[model samples]
Target: MENENLLKQISFIKEIDKIKYIQRRTKLFNSDRNENDAEHSWHLAMMAIVLAEHANEPVDVLKVLKMVLIHDIVEIDAGDTFIYDTAKDHSNTDEELIAAKRIFGMLPKEQAEEFIAIWEEFEEGKTNEAKFARSMDRFEPLLQNTSNKGGTWAELNVDYQRVYDKKKVINEGSTSIWNYSENLLNECVDKGILKK
Candidate 1:
């Protein structure tokens, strides 16, 4: 059973490599290349570690890292969802849950349960860790948009109010980050990169 579990774990690790192929709408900092789920996850983990000091409430850095790492693994199956695609119906919740089970289930039962619990906690976004993790999710793309001279927002014609609505979750995690994001948004508007 132990060897079988090891094999299962190996298979799961290999399976998640598909995440690298799942390209996001966000661009890399100072680059035109689109970012992938793997890079996004890694960036979020780093952000959790570096920005934990800015969180409004105390957070478990490891827990935040874990949440960001696995949060998008489901996208390997459900595909990447663009944040500003308001016309796209918000209907992927069920699909993502199914994907989460199939992907995380590749591990031993106990390990799968733990991963699923963390993923679910992220989806719920209520705990301090989850809130902070979600903040990173929103904040990273904002940085990407700012860095790339208005990235997806400019390309998609997303307006300032919509951007604010989408990113207000940052306030729940870190007041400092939210303030910084607000200033960035204003700069984007002034630069005429983001729609006003």
Candidate 2:
């Protein structure tokens, strides 16, 4: 029955303990250390809360948190993609769409749809909520790189321009936050925290 399938899905949580999960081969932050998707999602949700004031327009932080927490569940099915991989030509959106149907479809009807909608909103990045949520999403890794001595950047041979290219999403959704981020990155550059 449809109801039966939904119930089963709700109870099935993908395991996040596997070391291979969310192990982005980044040269921007720490060396030989990889971040898990669950941790990244949780951290981004928290960053959304702490940095809500920097949004270009006021937004519902709770909604953003929900979006962040659930956004990458599909990654469990489709796998995480590295940011700088030239071969990763297909957008994560395509993979996640299939993943969403399978993952959220497991939950009960109403809840599944609600969660799927949130995930889709995040993928589209069209709404104020999605935009606000995404700014936090993009900012966290930059912070990780700068605070951790830009080990990731150093390994990747990253330049300031590459950093800006990767972080443009922050500016698109929230100029205030973007300004703050720019200032931070600039400081990091000045202090030799991020490679120029």
Candidate 3:
């Protein structure tokens, strides 16, 4: 049973490597190459750890890290939904839930349950850790876009109202970070990188 569990765990790890190929709409800072799900997840995990102190309410950094790292594994099968893509419909959560079950189920039962629970917690955005994790997920792409001189926002002509609508959740996690982001957004408009 131990060996069986080990094999399942190994298989799950191998399967998640596919996340590296799941490209997102955001580009790397000063680079043309689009970021992938794996890169995004890793970035958010690091942000969760580094920015935990800024969270409005205390959070379990480890839980936030776990939430960010595992939240997008579903994207491996469900495909990435661009936040600003008005043309393409947002990802169907039903499909993503199925993908999560199939992918995380590759692990042993207890481990699979824990991963799914973390993913759901992040999705629900109810707990302090989940809220903070969600903030990191949203904030990272904003930074990427700002760094790339409006990156996808410019290419798509995304406006201030739309950007604000997408990012308001950042305030739930860290008011300091949210304030910084708001300033950056205003700067983007002033610089003509994002539309007013």
Collision count for each candidate, in order:
0, 6, 0
TM-score (C-alpha, index-matched) for candidate 3: 0.96
TM-score of each: 0.96, 0.83, 0.96
lDDT of 3 by residue, 32-104 (tens): 8999998889899888888999999999898898998898899888889888877766634898899989999
Which stretch of 10 consecutive residues in model 1 shows the poorest summed lDDT? 83-92
Overlapping backbone residue pairs in candidate 2 total 6
Candidate 3 structure lDDT: 0.90
Q: Where does model 3 exceed 4 Å of error? A: 87-92
- Give the TM-score (vs. native) of candidate 2: 0.83
Clashing pairs in 3: none
Q: For model 2, which pairs clash?
A: 9-106, 27-152, 27-153, 28-152, 28-153, 29-152
* lDDT for each candidate structure: 0.91, 0.76, 0.90
Worst 10-residue stretch by lDDT in candidate 3? Answer: 84-93
**lDDT tens digits by residue: candidate 1, 80-152:** 8787776664434888989989999999999999999999998888999999999999999999889998888
- Report residue 97 deviation for candidate 1 (angstroms): 0.5
